[model samples]
Target chain A: MSRFIEIVEVGARDGLQNEKVVLEPADKIELVRRLDACGARRQEVVSFVNPKRVPQMAGAEEMIAELAGAPGRSRIGLVLNERGWDRAVAGQCDEANVVVCATDGFGIRNQGASSAEQIATLAAIAAKRQAEGGPPISLTISVAFGCPFDGEVSEDQVVAIAQEGAALGLAEIALADTIGVADPWTVRKRVEAVRKVIGDIPLRMHFHDTRNTGIANAYASVEAGVRILDASVGGLGGCPFAPAATGNIGTEDLVYMLERAGFETGLDLGKLIETAHWIGGKIDKAPVSGLSKAGPFPKPAE
Target chain B: MSRFIEIVEVGARDGLQNEKVVLEPADKIELVRRLDACGARRQEVVSFVNPKRVPQMAGAEEMIAELAGAPGRSRIGLVLNERGWDRAVAGQCDEANVVVCATDGFGIRNQGASSAEQIATLAAIAAKRQAEGGPPISLTISVAFGCPFDGEVSEDQVVAIAQEGAALGLAEIALADTIGVADPWTVRKRVEAVRKVIGDIPLRMHFHDTRNTGIANAYASVEAGVRILDASVGGLGGCPFAPAATGNIGTEDLVYMLERAGFETGLDLGKLIETAHWIGGKIDKAPVSGLSKAGPFPKPAE
Candidate 1:
């Protein structure tokens, strides 16, 4: 097995934020505690976005405050613009994840800006954070693979955004398959291209299992020298913009594949599946995670 | 696009024969007719197994006789033992598919024999058919990649068995990933091994997408010079012995991949998805095919 790969647990923030039913602050805190107990060192705990636009994320400040007092684990928050960034700094999140979509359509729809404008804003935030000696910031480039409305996002656009973030000294850069349209070859090509431009900054991958290629794409990225992966527990996250998009690559499922292929993921499969089953109980429907339904491979003898 | 790959539609026999529900003979006939209408040149319509054990396949004779009367398509029947060979000969199927499990455990469980014993039986049947000027026989080596009871099947065993089958003058040989446990690296190595042993015989791949690695493995096989593929409509087959094994590579899904990669499959994606939907309705559950759910890539405008 290679050196331990960091699995930044995103289910608490990215997973729950997309749910139609807003979760209570208590439930959000409990979810974070449960994830911490299951060996997740880093977690995206909340999004510091306005309640007017995203009602599900309305109580982000309270959720962050509750989690800040919780024992164990490092917490991060997602932010789209300077308002969210200000809230993230005020909430004292250990890290803040700023996102910029690769295409114009998803950028306008997700963050209310063009790609160029969003990149400029993200660069300014990164520069300001660098100057303030504040908490570290990561840049997640959403729709780096493709877009629902725009279609076929070019590698040049993704490279330019990644290079811009790299120049601003972003802590990490994550390329997201927001619409779940990337194949292994495309993932390998894009990751290599981005790596060439960025020159050795930490790279992460986030993929959706919309067309059932998420896990394979994740492995391909790993083969292309990516160590950090963003996955929701039980594959809970889905893009509200892409109608057919169903789930992200399940955390337990990804761990199973990684552990089996001689990689150290630092996750307990049984406990993660139990967490998935627990979350599934709280949600309206059961998720489509493979490990949850199939259980672990090579079951113990009765 | 490369030359058109022959996708052998095996849902009618391999897909439904293992199901608990015994579909009506009319429904079975209609399923085959619909698959033929969707431009499937070769269809495995039924199995010549004993009804006492496999009751779902009891009406194989009736189905085969009816489909044999149709024009312009090759109708094949899956045969297990000498009794099945007798039945296939009597019914005059366009082709008789003889199966041999690569591992001893699955061979005994599936066909009640050892691998060598099954190969000898197939050789005897092939000789008899040659003497009688009967239709060609194709041998499919099941579990060529890996087995459930016996983990990590060796390529040596697969090649040894395939060499014997090739020596018997079999028309074609297929390597079945019965448990869906193969990765692309494994597929390439194993396919290359079998190709070396069986000189000029056309190789076919039968893969199950249980672990979501099937299409990627199929792509690797295509890159390894394989032109024939076995897919159940709607990704519908699983080995009775391997628990929780579901979703063979769906015909529509596989065609979508092949067509997108600039390979000709001679399949109509629209018609294929429609037929899969029809089959799903007949079974009273939507199939687990990604293409059926997500539609073709670069989805046409509404």
Candidate 2:
């Protein structure tokens, strides 16, 4: 009944960014269009990074140009530094998602900076975008739950970064469980801690289903008052930087949990599963989504 | 560390009972011995059921007798009806686990009776066991969280049934998430409801990892004051009667969560995983445990 929950689809950018096989720009555009038609108002369509480092995301500008005339969807581009931000701005993307890792190892590996420097850089980018009257920007703190390098990230560290992002007037602050090691208790505690520091700021959760606790952790976050969630269609995304990092929480699976728990997700789970199935066919690998394999709950009697 | 948590390993019985392939009685006895040597104080050895319906549990008598002589371990046997109870008593089991389904559809399929009839039968068996000075008996209500046939089992119904079991002076009561459809909220609410009705009766949780929420739900139950848990070694068990029901939550995986969350499980997770791997080899399939595949959290840097 309530339409408060926002499903920020991140499959196209975060999901496809690390693939060994590069997709054509036209194929990326078609994927965005399909997600929009399936009721995704916000989609992370591409990442603005160097072509040599991440060849899969090399055609970000071209893909953006293809979808520039497409209607009814807000396309967000993920950016790592000033150069990436400039690329996103020139591409005329609707939003920019800047990330700052909670630990030094991941921050350096992901963005080649210390945690403090990364936060400072993200804040400067947010400020610069505001100064130029550019599109809105949001900051996501990755490895907020636990880091592959630094285990058990403290809530205080996450809160401090979120507060800094809030001070920069960021659109939203999301806590990313980059490695999928967070349990429900950790999720609830971290989300609550961040909420205390960034009062009234929209908070989102990004979870990976590495250990199969992703959906449960997401539900725990929802109970702790999180509304926006980041998921990959068919559980497609994983961090190429973090060792053994698995797929993000599948969008279809998340929708199933939300709708069945009496929350409105504004997405068709059956259609989402079908889309995941279709995408899996294209990728030539079966998805790891439980709902796709197990089907919905209260299975019809034989 | 507080050694308060006890994991009742049920793979030998509840886990093996549902398999389509029938294992030899000698193999079953060897599995029980291996689990006991791994520090499982309580092992559910076998189920005394009709061989025509459940061929896997056909040698319950011989398996129970062999496991009863096992050094320093309590051997538990499952019984559905009064006939099964006769077999358990004849086998001289250390404990008898009586089962009653929370909903009518599951009750008929599992126990061939209505909920009321099942409750009455369980109460009568408890009273008779006490009067005869037989072994201590524990009652576990299957589908306590939700039933595959009936969606959304009410907390009131579960509490009433728990009260019925408590009135019979059952040594313990376990609530089973028969179909793996419960979230953390559902687990907490139901456990709290049953706790309110049956004061001071030790509560146990039997969960399956079919939908990947099993360990999280178990954590929630533990937070809600349930100390005893049922886990299948290597995630072995599922309900043969419940269609589409997958493996139970793995004991090694459960222990990992408990120990990491600062709860003392008194079980060595690495040894448990090794035991699971060994058992999996015997069964001709890899164990369905995530921790076995992912390794423990906070893995040492390479």
Candidate 1 C-alpha lDDT tens digits along B1-302:
35688999999888887666678878989998888888888999888888888877778888888888467789998988778888888888898899999989888877889888898899889888888766678889998877777766888999999999999988999998877766766787889999998899999998887666677678778768899999988887665654555667889878876675567877788888898888888777677776777776677668
Write one digit per residue (lDDT tens) for candidate 2, span A1-302: 24468999998887777655677787777777777767888899988888788887878888887765357678998888888899888988888899889999888887899999988888789778767866788888998888877788888889999999889888888999887777777788888888988888899899887666777688788878899999888888655544344588888778876676677877877677777777777666676666666666766346
Q: Residue A64 in model 1: shift from native, Å?
A: 3.4
On a 0 to 100 scale, what is the lDDT of residue A49 in model 1? Answer: 78
Please give the interface root mean square deviation for model 2, in Å.
3.3
In model 2, state the lDDT of residue B79. Answer: 86
Which ranges in model 1 have alpha carbons more than 4 Å from their true place? A1-5, A66-74, A241-245, B1-5, B69-72, B223-225, B238-245
> Ten residues in a row with the worst lDDT in model 1 chain B?
B238-247
Residue pairs whose backbone atoms clash in candidate 1:
none
lDDT of each: 0.81, 0.81
Task: List, residue by residue over A87-197, the lDDT tens digit for candidate 1.
Answer: 888888888999999999988987889999988889788777877755688889998987887887899999999999999988889999877777776888899999998
- Give lDDT tens digits, candidate 2, residues B117-140: 998888788778877867788988
